[model samples]
Target chain A: MWGHVMSDEKKPVRKKLKAASEASRFMANYYHELDAASQKGQPKIAWCTSVGPAEILRALGFLVYFPETHAAMLGATRMSTELIPEANALGYSPDICSYLTADIGAFLRGVTPLSRIYKGIEAIPKPDVLVFNTNQCRDVQDWFAWYGKKFDAPVLGIYTHRNVGKITEAHVASIAKQMQELIEPLEKVSGRSFDLDRLKRVVALSRACSELWRNVLETASAKPSPLTFFDGTTLMGPAVVGRGTREAVDVYKILLAELNDRIKDKEGAIEDERFRIYWDGMPVWGRLRAHSDLFSGLKASVLASTYCNSWIFSALDENDPFNSMARAYTELFIVRSDDEKETYIKKMLELFKVDGVIYHDAKTCPNNTNCRYGMPQRLEQQTGLPSLTINADLNDMRMISDEQTQTNVEAFIEQLEENQT
Target chain B: MKSKPCYAGVDVGASRTKVAILDTSKNLIGHAVKKSGTDFTATADACLILALKMAGKKKSDIKNTVSTGYGRKNVSFARDTKTEIGCHAKGCFLYFPFATTIIDIGGQDNKVIKLDRSGKRTGFKMNRKCAAGTGAFLEEMAMRLDVSLEEMNGLASQSKNMIKLGSFCTVFSATEVLENIRQGKNLPDIVKGVYYSMIKRVLEMDALTEKVVMTGGVVAHNAFMVKMTEEMIGRKILVPDYPQLTGAIGAALYAMQNKP
Candidate 1:
């Protein structure tokens, strides 16, 4: 939990006023609908997302799998793009979105090269229900909408509105109540008992993951840093799909061992690492190498990203799932308002101690992009950290200005270096 | 002494592969396009062989080979694979140096390229995601109702009524097309709706949206440029003689360049 603590300087402090007046009544009406008298079997629900939201749901005992994560690994191996045309022939528009078109294309062609959903290249299993949080990008939301329409299943869009200005008590209460209400539907669908104890356990797991993630970020504070964002990214997959599980914990332990070994050797994710930069916002989905090479020549190592640390909440499950999940979901960096968002950045600067931040203003993504204008200014003014705002689409070339983006990044790094002396 | 071997540039597109051949002086000796096959290797070979036969040269006469498009890396025969972006920039510089913006509406993807006087890749954007305005989207709608792609465009230009394409998703748009038809909207008006909707989608991504016009698959098939789009944006969109084949010609001419 980067934070959800109450702050005073923040304004527009309206505490769950609407929920108190309206949504609360709806919640009571729905809660009695369950009452342990009418509800029977817990519905078989599956959580779906990229790395960020998957970890949060995993803590709550929800079975989760990441389609984008699976798709990216395929893309990394160069399978999805190959399947684009066939997917188009099957009625998926190639222009609709590359990932969707490609994956469906691969499915239609029946020639995808992936080995498995997990290692050893096995078949992917489909879940009865899908849950997604809208903290990452709106594309996931739209993509999931297709999934919902195709499967004709219930689609839950968890909107985590970013508080760009400042946070107040009203903000926390408004969101907390939303979180409590959002889960009731799940309880109705799953028939899983919702108790304070369960949420607390989920919260504890969130804290553990966040704590481990914080330690990893702290490792970047070293001069000529022992770890790179690549190392952090690889470790993130486990959290993405298996968080709150014993398997996820083991995945991190193994990854941590490997990363620690590399750090001790003073080896970077890529050798000849020079600049240690922070990557903010969603990754350019398709042009990953191009995105990396945009700064690769500068010896720049993107050590931390806002997306990578997004799900890292501080509250850990001492025990129970309800309190833990409630607190953790409520505490997500993107889910919180001005107080939490600003404080999260401040904490990252204190922890990672990086010199620069490249705020990737993903063109189509309002959730991540909305925070940039005011956020960069505030972070720089207080931390004295140099920041550059680059406009590019997340994973789509439709919005990237490669030449201008390159020139900007180069100039920003130069300006940063000039000031270091 | 070794003679400077000829080079081949083949664009294995979604529906077709347009190939071009050039010698040491980088002159375009021959050019041909064939229906792209199901397999990448087969399509690459068919296009290359056709270009070679037209050039009166053997496969060995080809010193180097380049493949571009989404299938760039899959070309088992290519010496090196460059993205369609790089190749398009090189080709557009050679073909239309003054054309600041290049819009390529292939069967599936829509890409907008910005080039400098020197043809360097100044910046470019592709609709890697979203199908609200692509040529493929229009084609699907055309086939669903058993209307020809040509008739889809021609009939659309004839209509004056506005048929709003409310949903941004392609499948949903197809459904919307059907829904409009059920609502007694005339065939021509439905076609008009698709063209108008596409232009709006294009405007969202193109930095030079208002200033540019037809030069890809969409221009050729549904040859009618969305007049409403031009009027809405208040700018003229330049249309080349053959918008469909411009990219191939651009690729062919790019191969003609002697410059490194």
Candidate 2:
């Protein structure tokens, strides 16, 4: 609800800075696969997780692309799933993963069913280097492998280890060598030097912003506080993409100011949070809105979520990007077991002060699986909080049961109300 | 009399191929299940041939044919192919009509589907790239449990203590099962726990928060259906009367609707 105020005379300049200039800088292109035009004059080459990849590339004055995001967009608009049988018809087969087949179709057809949104997509200049992190899905590795073979583009991949609780010597050495390798192409692409001091300084700025954002989440524990996970979703951009920069600092200052004002005013982000809720694990990208909409329609509010947070406060800490990254990886609820996942779940429940948790075990993810076989029962045994678990790809809706899901949720709430009495 | 219009459906299961045939109104005329071969097309043909013979109809007698399952399109006979999902949704809605959610735990993969009142394919989450909590996993355990695949469920119902199958990955779950056995955990509890573990993976993968209409080869065969429902969802699970045939029925209906 807070708008940036500007002097009347400087309005035009601020508008350009926010929209046009920044849009030009948002040049990061992070597609899992780049099509073959064999064009030489590409802008930048980089990779990132589905969430941070595009934003980081843009920060580097590069264009960002993502195959999964494109796939989800297709699923969202309903054109991609419609073409599944056709793709399978041509030879892909029903056995093939839909993302690959749909992408192959979208590439061959030359126009996505919703092509206008990504105009000049294929024509965007070539990437100087491709950058990626092994954070979400292992399919990313294969996706990039295909891209590397197709374009023979210089690829830089980051390893966000799945099962490891801490970064071992092997993990550090492998990625350290990778980080060393990143130096050459990155320098060659931007024609800029990889200044270690500059990078550290930038990460520090990012850390500051994250701390503030983390505090924003922490403050929500109080009676009527500033923001919710919904508002924080909008605020997640800078911490992810705009980190380690003066602009990052400026943007966060504005956000924290608004939040503090809300705290002083004793108000919540929304007018009336009908049913406070906590979201556990990654936010189902395709279903995020549908999820929120479903809950919102029922006058149920999602006050916080694990996906929107992603342990940002810890990972973005200035103490040593390497050490901090490793420490953050160790704390992830999915990669750990027993005490860790339970401790975090308890913390989230306590911090969000919500009545229940909607856990999203995204299909196709290796690191995320749990709490069945009386596991959720254990949660019931321990925390005495209600738990609702559902299955479906984070975005793929080829098979989802919304009505049944709604029924379960309503019944759970009914039981919760009865229990409280 | 109108020539009996013959219809066919094939299920490309993990270890086996099941085929069914029906007249135009969709009454099952004949059905056959056979071990799947290595080659895709050959397995499909063998299943189709067996099903056609059982229906007492030559391949040429079929006016229209629809194919479903993992191998639907791989079959040379299918005019077109649809995912096991669309066919299942269509098939389940025809039977239950009010079934808004369908959970199919198959041999190779677990598919959780959400259907509308009219049986339109809406949203879904299939399992990861491997078999974690699926029919294949169950069979492997059944072999170790000394219970026939057909009798494992019945034996499971007779057990007293809960064996903990703690691993979520099938590979890990297998090792974990052996470890629990070595630790002297009761067999029924272990089998029940294994089923629950698989159910848990399905829950995380699909985001399932509903009363699920459970169907598939495993649901029909598993005797611990009640315990599985309670453990996986911490609630009750409902299944169709003849759950295993849902996929075949869906395939036939899909074949009939889009016949061109």
Return the TM-score for candidate 1, rounded to 2 decimals: 0.53
> Which portions of model 2 miss their true places by more than 4 Å?
A1-43, A50-125, A166-174, A185-192, A224-235, A311-334, A366-375, B1-260
Query: For model 2, what is the error of residue B166's alpha carbon versus the real structure, in angstroms, after optimal superposition?
Result: 23
**TM-scores, in order shown?**
0.53, 0.53
List the DockQ of the predictions in order.
0.02, 0.02
Summarize candidate 2's per-residue lDDT along A151-263 as a digit string, tens digits.
Answer: 67776776665555445677555544555555666667666666655556655776676676677566666555455565555455555555455665566566666667667
Docking class of 1: incorrect
Error of 2 at B198 (Å): 17
lDDT of 1: 0.59
Q: Tell me what fraction of the real C-alpha contacts between chains A and B each candidate also makes.
A: 0.00, 0.00
Residue-wise lDDT of candidate 1 within B123-150, one digit each (tens)? 4555634666787787788887778876
